[model samples]
Target: MELTYLRTFREVAKWGSFTRAAEALGYAQSSITTQIQKLEESYGAVLVERFGRGMKLTIAGEALLQYANDIYRLHEESKEVVSKQSKGTLSIGTIETLAAFFLPPKLQAYRRDYPDVNVVIQPGNEPFIIDSVKEGALDVGIILDPPFSDPELHVNILREETMAIIASPDHRLGELSEVRVEDLESESLIMTEDGCTYRAMLLKVLKGNQVNYNLSYEFGNLEAIKQCVIYGLGIALLPRITVAEEIRKGQIVAVPFVHPECKFYTQLIYSKKKWQSKAFLGFVELIGGINHQNH
Candidate 1:
């Protein structure tokens, strides 16, 4: 079996979808399928089976996955050992909010400490970030609370971030110290796109309380949402860390949420199965130091 086939199989199994594996690996979907077929042919056993729109690994596939991870980890370790004196680049992923506010200073510190090491940052939503980490496309991921649990991953809770309802300084709700869910029944809301943990939490609260409000707009970017609120387009519910500077500048006011569930944690996640390089370890330590100083 070619090593490339094993790599393709690993990505497909990690993502549980051939298309996702193709996208991550920058290969055609047919190429991914062909590689898996070759692997099955080489082993003379069915490795993957498709059911409905999703796919699952068969018993043989599951057994091989462990070996594949071991092989890949060993390969990475060998490279790291040879280059032990000079750790190379580290790829990191994070959500938009943290990318804008939380990561700059921490990343600055990391760059200052490791001037020779290169760093690449990719911004994505929680699911994409977690999957990228699991697939080994990213060395580390910083995300808001992941939606599901995976045994193959390690999660570190960096901090608990509280959500707030933000609006222009002169908006009707801006003067309130706190707003009940019912108070927003008729108000216009600007929200991030689906798959955001905080957005899901806010929706659950509104639905549970039977609050019917206007969703005036949905934005995929946090900065756009903030700008919309700054011009009095509509109020938004976002992590306080993201809007702190705006709140401090008096451009926006963060009204407290009476519902207690408006809080979630930020996490640093990585694959337990992947090899952790010296550069990765040092970068994680840098983030820890940043969090410590913040506290």
Candidate 2:
């Protein structure tokens, strides 16, 4: 029945380990166990259960968690409205490229306008970002992806960002003004993580053309990918904005490689069910200016 107990339960569910939840909440592991026990007593059902190496929610635990999420959301909303603090944390989840290149200016201005509000930036994959928003784990998200929509979240398109092929300035493919799919036959390729939208697009195009290629390198970090391309390890496909400065500095070249599927956009998203606090709206407005300017 206590709010803190529900919070502890949520944390336990989030971490899936009593020890981890305790560490994250700055409590003793025994305290975490006590809280989970208290929650089960209040609800009259067993909650979490062991799942191999970790823990998972029991059927009753899953049922309570859904309501727990709503309760937490509503309590935060009540605190914001009743107390009028004008202060809260805005947790934003974004992919690495947008975190580095697209959001800095907008987030800077957002901070200036809402000096009391704290911002937490979580760099992660697109699906994780979307899932976090839906779960009320993140206040908002910025991502570079193709036209996206979810019944649980509101999607706002920032702008269309063209995909480009990047390679060392002296790579053989750079000699051509435009690099066609066939032109890359048997060529080495540096790639981003497997599920990356741009990486998937590149592979789909090549497969459609039946162009055999080599996966010379696969990297989870953008800097590593760029460095590999710079060293002539292989050519890579990525959003153009990510390599604009490198191309300008002559560290890399953006080869023209256009495909319909390669066309993606920067987008802002938030859960439709979430209560928009004043700080949240302020941040959205700042990002809106970027959306307007880019049009």
Candidate with maximal TM-score:
2
The global Cα lDDT (0 to 1) of model 1 is 0.84
Candidate 1 residues lying further than 4 Å off, grouped into runs, are 1-70, 146-150, 289-295
lDDT for each candidate structure = 0.84, 0.87
Q: Write the per-residue lDDT of candidate 1 for residues 165-281, one digit (tens) a residue.
A: 899999888878887788898889999999888889888989999999899999998889999999999999988888888988989999877677765778787777666667767
Candidate 2 has which clashing residue pairs, if any? Answer: none
lDDT tens digits by residue: candidate 2, 48-136 = 99998888999999998898999999999999999876698999999989989998998888878899998999988898899999999
TM-score of 1: 0.76
- In terms of lDDT, the best-performing candidate is 2
